[model samples]
Target chain A: MVQRGLLIVLSGPSGVGKGTVRKAIFKEDGVDFRYSISATTRKPRPGEVNGQDYFFVTREEFEDKIQNGDMLEYAEYVNNYYGTPRSFIEETLASGHDVFLEIDVQGALQVKTKMPEGVYIFLTPPDLKNLRSRLVGRGTDSAEVIEKRVAAAKDELKMMINYNYAVENDVVSKAVDRIKAIITAERLRVTRVLGELDN
Target chain B: MVQRGLLIVLSGPSGVGKGTVRKAIFKEDGVDFRYSISATTRKPRPGEVNGQDYFFVTREEFEDKIQNGDMLEYAEYVNNYYGTPRSFIEETLASGHDVFLEIDVQGALQVKTKMPEGVYIFLTPPDLKNLRSRLVGRGTDSAEVIEKRVAAAKDELKMMINYNYAVENDVVSKAVDRIKAIITAERLRVTRVLGELDN
Candidate 1:
């Protein structure tokens, strides 16, 4: 029997180290899994590549997808378009490889409506004080930028109510371990295909 | 914030090695949990202690508790009564130590109705042939007894639709490890009592 793949949606507040923890999880990977390549109308930054880093598209193409519901989740930001393509995710799922998508709270909610059973993991910082320190420690964003990010965190926390699991990103290793465990546990979900063996 | 324990229910065909796997999991120790004890009117075998192996009671007391909705699940077997008491399970859950219950398939459905979100684990033998081999391997039961057990296995398999997860008893270690991982993963459920921390 072909075992079904789990779709794990990961979201967290800014400065919570989700990127660092996710990097550690995908760092030592042997299994076949697709890291979702989001499409954006915005130009790629330096050192970023099209297709691999993202599926760069024109605003027209992004809007067409949103109109057709080809985008599983999408939102307009800063006069630019960003969205997750429906075809790519379906292909990955059909191939029996679990897929991970790192999206913001808004995208996560949109995906939940389309796929109600997708396991969600909300990444949390160790504490508010630590979160502030991490933002200041980055040294790239200005004080105003840090303040905006903190404000955005408050909005993101409200959307996490739909998340099925939560892990505090205090230590990269521990957080990655917890995320990995959540994936492992999700694979055992009774409604999934591999889990049907006992029945 | 205090974390509440999960209510986990396990059911499987008899002689499929669930007992051995459960024992192996608890042997690691330090993981404090209570295995729910049932109230029964059946006469205790040698070495069995009241309120330990089971809450040995008279038929009148068992019936009284059932009338009062104290028994979580109850069934008549071999002209005797056996059932899980609700008070012990409720107290154990209140103490924040996960309560694990091993009951027959019928009782499992009963427990699931009371706690829909409870984690359910269904154990299956490696295969039907192996199940019979193990049942007969014991050398204590007659051929007729073995046949009856095999028939019961088929009936149990049909009720598997109610389970949330299933673990095959291919090897004792593999089965026990799956059960342990389920428990570990359940601890990470975000919406339990520790849900206040999400803020």
Candidate 2:
């Protein structure tokens, strides 16, 4: 089999530590994945380059790409336009490398809609109590804000049914371990890299 | 964590080398797994013992278990009975050991219906050519029968979606390696072994 990268889309509710697992996959496991950068209409923050942090584009350019099929998937958030570019992913896949899309549930669905073969994995919180505790422990939001986040989690849980695989983040390190194993196992799936077996 | 025996169900298409992988898993990896002894209502063969190859029992006894919720799953054919008994599996799981059920897709599904939490894996033929070649090259079946087997295999592929994980049998060693990794990876699912997690 070719040493091609896997187009892995890891999405989960907040506080599930997907970022941590994503970083570990790159640093510890040597995934060699090219992160799919998003193109947004929002202004780039300080020290964030237009093409580096995001392809900071004008509203007209975002609209042109949306009409021209240049983006794999995109959405408007808080009136700010954001989209994943198709050319960037296509280039990486052509070079036989995997691309990682660290996006939300809606973004993942849009991606799946575009790339039916893209592997979608949902990282779930172990339990409700723990998910709530995690939201609180993060110390990033007020109690009322945490309540809203937990409420939003219920809606996210409903979307798990659409995902091909679900990995529980009870222990972030262990979740990372399973994520790696899953990627390894999926690499052996007949539909993808290996294709139909001759033997 | 207590070392509990896993009630493993291995089912896949013919000529996929399921038996070879099963043996290698134990011999090469030294993983402890018991091959489940099936029960039958048929009388013992000329040299067969009741509890060795099968736990031979009367029709009345087999029916009684089915009626009393004792038999795990059973199938009758050609005036003979084949069933998996509940006692042995329950004992094995409780004894901190795992039992390996090498059976067909129907049998695996029956066991899953009885025990939803059991680990389920489906092995696929390495490729369409290897699949057909293996069945025909074996020369155990005539061309007509071989055609029928291949047709049946096409139908079996549909059930791959039902399996928790799918392992493709391309390279025997590679298949075994992924399967070993799967079992190891499953141990980390968290939902499967919550009690084993550190506090």
Candidate 3:
């Protein structure tokens, strides 16, 4: 009996170490996990690989996919469209590979509305002070932007009520371990196991 | 901020290796786990300790505890009463130690109705044949009794639908690992973490 893979949605406020934890999970060998390559109209960064990091697409193509109902969830930010393609996730899960979707809180909420069965995990910082320091350490945003992010994080913390699990990113490895445990436990869920065994 | 420990309820059909996996978990170090000692009117066999293996009590005392709403769940089998006391489980969880309740399917269902928040895990054999062999290998029951158990296991498999998680006991170590993962994942539940951090 082949078990269908899980759709795991991971989200948190900016600079909560979601990327770090995700990288750690992928670094481990033998995990049947696949990152859902997002379709984005935004230009790839210097180190980013098209189709690998993100599915770089033309603005018109992204909009066309949305129009065709091909996008699972999509949003426009800074005049660039970013969204998850429904077909890739469906095909990957059908092939028995767990798909990880790392998006913002808003985008995750959108995905939750569409795929309520997906595992929703909220990554959190140890505390507000740690979050501010991490955002500052990134050196990607101005101080004003950092302050705005901190304010937004406080609001995001409240939104954790909507998530099924909350993993604290105190240590990157510990956060990854917790997420891995969640995935392991999710695979053993009676609904999934019964369906697999019944076959 | 202390996160309250989880209440983990484990139940499966007889001879499914629940005891083995549980013993393996307790043998591991650094696990703050407490077993919920059950109250039973049955006389303790050799090597059994009061308040450890079973809380031996008179039939009248057991009935009184049930009447006083102290028993979490209780049952009579072959004129012997076996039950879990409500206070011990509550106190253990309140003191931040995860309490493990190892019981049968009937007792687990009864406890579920009383403590809906507990994590319910159903253990199962790889197949009916394996279950039969395991029951027979125990050398404690006759062929007739083993047949009755095998028939009952088929019915219990259907009850898996009502359980939150089902861990297959194909290998004792693997089952223990899955259950530990479950406990780790449950601790990261959004409600628990949020409440802990809010304090």
Candidate 4:
């Protein structure tokens, strides 16, 4: 019996290290999940390969996909559109390959609305104070920008109520372990395994 | 703040090796759960301690507990009563220590009615044919008794629909690992971690 694969959506507030944790998860052996590369209208940076870094597309083509209901979730920033394509995820899942999506909190919420069955995981910082320290340590933003970013993160934390699980990203390896456990547990769920049992 | 400990209920059909798996789980390091000792009216076998093996009680006292609703779940077989006391599980959980209950399918269903939040796992054989062979392999039972047991197991397997997880006991260690993963994943659920986040 071919069981449909799980859709794992990982999201968190800005600077919560979702990317680092996701990368670590893939680096580990036996973690078999297809990362859903998103489509974007933004210009690729130097040495960025098309279809590998992203499905780089024209603005008109992206708009056509949006109108066709082909985007699982999408967002616009600085006149550039970035969105998850629905077709690839559907086909991958149909073929019994789990798909992993790493996106921002807003995008995660949008995907949740479109596919509520997906396992929505909210990666969180150990604490707000720790998050602030990390932002300061980055040394990229000025005082005003840092304050604004912190405030935005605070608001985004509230969105965790929409997630199925909230994993504290205090340590990247620990977070990855929890994510792996979640996948293992999900596969054992009675609702998901009943089909296999019947066969 | 002391978070309430999880109540894990492990149940399955007859001859599914629930006790063997539960013992293995406790033998492993880092499994901090307390095994809930059951109160019973049956005479203990040799080498069985009162509090450790079973809380041996008289028929009068056992019936009194049943009358007082102190038994979380109970069954009477061959004029002897077997029951789980409600107080110990509640106290352990309130003290932030997880309690593990290994019981029959009927007892598990009863516990679920009282504590629906408990994580109920149903351990299944790889197949019904395998279960039949296992039953036949046990030299203790007559052919007639083995057939009856197999029929009863078939009926009990239907109860798996009410459980949160159904893990196949094809391999003892694999089933134990799945149960551990279920516990770990449950700890990270958003509903359980929200209070920690607020703190």
Candidate 5:
């Protein structure tokens, strides 16, 4: 039997560039993992593909999934339900395909409770000072708002303690390289590769 | 203070190409880690540098080190004592330089007892059949001897349970790449990088 694929969760505080890094990882060649497409009740955009983009579903269907525990994690926002379908992830992993999830810290924590074996990676800024500067450099938020955001970022950084790895998003390519290395290394872990020996 | 560097121990069954893989890793540019130099009581061959090749020392000196508990692990062969010096490894790590030890399984187990935090990697052949073929390809051993060697290899393969990773030495460069990735991923482990966050 083929070994189950790894579940890699990438998360961090707001504006730490988790999305950007995840996008870069997918774009890179030789990365063999599936991007988890979330199921959402919101209407699809003009160009969004049904399965390629989000797994668009009706509100009733999404709610039923949540009620039946089919949703790995779900959240309601602006009258729309969004969640990861439990069946898809399980089936994909069973077929020996890795599943990558890019989510927020709170969402990642929820996934962790459900899949403790997943590799949780916290994408951190170069440093707290750098993070604060990036927040301030936005120039869109007021000084008071930036200060509050900085404080919130500090709290989010504390959540990194729960992660298996803390990768610095110092450079997009560098962070991608590190994440790739992480996946490669994880695959070689004795716990994961021992199955081959048994054969 | 600089973070103490990691102690990476690479070992596996005899004739698994651990030494070849290690040499390839060091030859690759951008790979950073000190190859552990062993202390030995045997006289160095011509052109072998004092510290570069081996820390050649008198038998009395080697014995005194063992008495003082300065020898990390050692064994006597052909009436000559050979062992790793504890101080050199400690000093290198304390100075923020990773120390790599390429030793036999027995020596690796001894080092693991002393440094439980070290990353122990077991280099494995692609398969038992392949290992047997390699042994037979030598054309020097009798069939009975080859059979005994394969049996010993199987027992050694069982020791992989104690290692953090089991890398198949199918190709020298691929094995080197996996080892490099292991080091990269290890450097990002939360337990190790959390110290940077504390600042």
Candidate 6:
């Protein structure tokens, strides 16, 4: 029996270094994983490819997919539709490669309502101070915006209870190693293996 | 808040090399773990130390411990008492060291009833043929006994559903690595970390 891949949902507050940890995980060269791409009705920005940056589609096309249940989860923001394409995730998993959905907590919870079996992991900053430093390091937001983010992070920390695993991103490499262990352990889950056998 | 240790129950079929995988896991440095020692009323064989081999005790003493609810689990074989002591496991776990219980499926399930939160892992052979060869290689059992063990393994395989993880002992090192990953992941469980915070 062939084992199918896992659908992993990674959620965290902004500036938690999730992207850096994920990059480190992929850079290892042995982690067979793919990032889930979102479909959006919003127009692509400059230098952003339609399929690479986002699966840019018309509002009608995105709504049609949602109506047909092709979207894993969809939401309308600023009159633009954004959703996870179910077909790509299903296809990638059928091909025996893990798929990662690096979504926010709200979106991740929405996905859980649709696909409850997916592994939900929370990446947390070591502390709010470190998170503030990281946000400042990015230099993308004003001090007021960083303060708002820090406050929001406190609220998100409470949501850690909703996750299956919580890994502290004190060190990017250590955080990646913990996530890798989680994926490895999840692959050996009895329910997953039994499903393989029954196939 | 300090994180507590994990109670890990490792169980599988008789010939599945659970011991070897566990040995390899412990042989690696930085894995702070201890094996649960059982108390037995059976007399120690030559070259077997009382504390190192088994906690050799008189039947009266062993039965007294069981009567006092000090035994986590116990069984009688040929009028000899064998049981896991509760005090040592609690002490080891309190000291923040993972404790491995290498027992059969029956014993593992018994422990689960007492400690429902322990991580239960099932170690399986790659295939029935390999399991049979392993049983034969033991050279301690007769052909009839080997056949009985093989049949029992089939029954035990079904019990994998009761476990959290099922690791195939195809390569000893690989199996050990999977178990180590499980321990690492289990330590990051949200509930476990939450409890630490509450303290």
Task: Give fnat for candidates 1, 2 and onward, in order.
Answer: 0.29, 0.25, 0.62, 0.54, 0.55, 0.59
lDDT of 1 by residue, A64-154 (tens): 8888887989887899888898778878777787888888777888888887767888887666323456778788889988888777655
- How much does candidate 2 score in TM-score? 0.62
CAPRI verdict on model 3?
acceptable
**What tens-digit string does per-residue lDDT give for candidate 5 at A1-199?**
5678999999998889998999999999987889888999999999999988999999999988988888888899999988998889998899999999999888899889888888999998776535556666677888888778677766866898899998989999999999999999999998877664432
Model 2 Cα lDDT, one tens digit per residue, B1-199: 4556667778887667889888778886568888788889888889997777899889999898888877778898998778999888888787888888877888888888888777778887755545668887787888888788777766766776566667877888888788776676565444554433222
Worst 10 residues of 2 chain A by lDDT: A190-199
lDDT of 3 by residue, B1-199 (tens): 3457789998988888888888898887777688898899999999999988889999999999999999989888899998899988998888888898888888899899888889999998766435666777788989998888777766877888778999989898899899999988988888777666531
Model 2 misplaced stretches (Cα beyond 4 Å): A1-5, A42-53, A68-80, A90-96, A109-117, A124-164, A168-172, A188-199, B1-8, B12-16, B26-35, B42-54, B63-80, B85-99, B104-173, B183-199
Off by over 4 Å in 1: A29-31, A43-49, A127-157, A194-199, B43-47, B127-157, B193-199
Error of 6 at B14 (Å): 0.9
**Can you tell me the DockQ of model 1?**
0.25
lDDT of residue B99 for candidate 1: 88
Candidate 5 off by > 4 Å: A41-52, A56-69, A129-154, B41-69, B128-154
Q: Each candidate: how many clashes?
A: 0, 11, 0, 0, 0, 0
True-vs-predicted CA distance for residue A53, candidate 1, Å: 2.0
Q: Which one wins by lDDT: 2 or 4?
A: 4
The better-scoring model by lDDT among 4 and 6 is 4
Residue-level error in angstroms, candidate 5, position B48: 5.8
Poorest 10 consecutive residues by lDDT, candidate 6 chain B: B127-136
Isolated chain A TM-score, each model = 0.75, 0.78, 0.78, 0.81, 0.82, 0.80
TM-score of each: 0.80, 0.62, 0.82, 0.82, 0.82, 0.83
Candidate 6, superposed: residue stretches over 4 Å from native: A45-50, A128-154, B43-53, B56-58, B128-154
Q: Which candidate do you rate higher for DockQ, 2 or 5?
A: 5
lDDT of 3 by residue, A105-176 (tens): 988988888778889999887764356777777899999998887887678777898899998888998888
lDDT per residue, candidate 2, A50-142, as tens digits?
768899999999999999988778888899998999888877876788888888887888888887777778887776434567766788889
